[model samples]
Target: MRVYLPATFNSLTELNESGVIHARSGWAFAVTDALREFYTSGDEEELSDVAFDQAALASLRLLAVGDVEKFPHRRVVVSADVDDAHVTPVPDNGESVVRLEPAAVELDDVAAIHVDVPDAEEATAKAVTAIDAADLGDEDAELTVGDAQDNWLAFYDPSELPVLIELL
Candidate 1:
């Protein structure tokens, strides 16, 4: 997944000097720890703890592969480390793309509540109700089985969630 960075942090060297990246709370700190490990590898004098921290923040956008441009905003640059960074682009007649595997399933053990609603013949009402009744809020939910037109299947675990309806 790609995230956009601000215009100010447009260069790797600049970010290195500054030392930090802005990102969502949960994930950014882990990335910071990894960055600290990278910058503090050599002699103490050669590394600047403060600088490294700034660089980590400046690298708001990171790719599993280091292509900064792939991120949505072009204003800020992609950040890469010299030692571990891959310099060469993978071969594709400019058509090759990086593929990300589905993340490991880490569903919480919340009790799952399943409710069945009267099926709607048309896709539109069924889809809207299915999406709304699920009431996922900010949580991740999937319409696993059917599409918007045919049928709707929304699954939520009650252990980590409240009641969720699977509209047919």
Candidate 2:
């Protein structure tokens, strides 16, 4: 199973040091049946983008409640392939939601990461402030968050971050 786990910049530093990842949200995401139903016409890759977008929103949720001084405003999503047995569909939640144990994953298990870059911080911070309202079905708030997501994320292989960290 391929899972997209929400994370923060601080967690990435921890992964760099301790070599383990504890997803801030116990839930991860995937192209589940719920997602397929919600998005009736899309390829696997397109559905995967929906899943990744879900994780990015989860990341924003984390930032909204976390100590703002401690975590940077950027959102992070860790993409990894894990055993199917380790993943469980979350039907009660919205499309693409799933549950996965943090202990079952490690840095070495990751395939790639999608994160908002430095320039995204300002827009991301604005999105963070509106995520709660967005989740509550506010159309305006959803658009605010969606706008932030549509821009500024950079993709990286797990190996690229260590080198980019210093410069980023």
Best by TM-score: 2
Candidate 2 structure quality by residue, lDDT tens digits, 92-147: 99788888864447888889877887787788888988988998999989898988
Which run of 10 residues does model 1 get worst, by summed lDDT? 96-105
lDDT of 1 by residue, 1-168 (tens): 221122221232232333332222212111223334555464542333233232222232222113334222211222212211212222231111111121111122112212122342243233333443333552221241123323322223433221221121
TM-score of 1: 0.15
Clashes of each: 18, 0
Cα lDDT, all candidates: 0.26, 0.82
Q: For model 2, state the Cα shift of residue 40 in Å.
A: 1.8
Best by lDDT: 2
Local lDDT at 156 for model 1: 32
Candidate 2's error at 42, in angstroms? 0.8
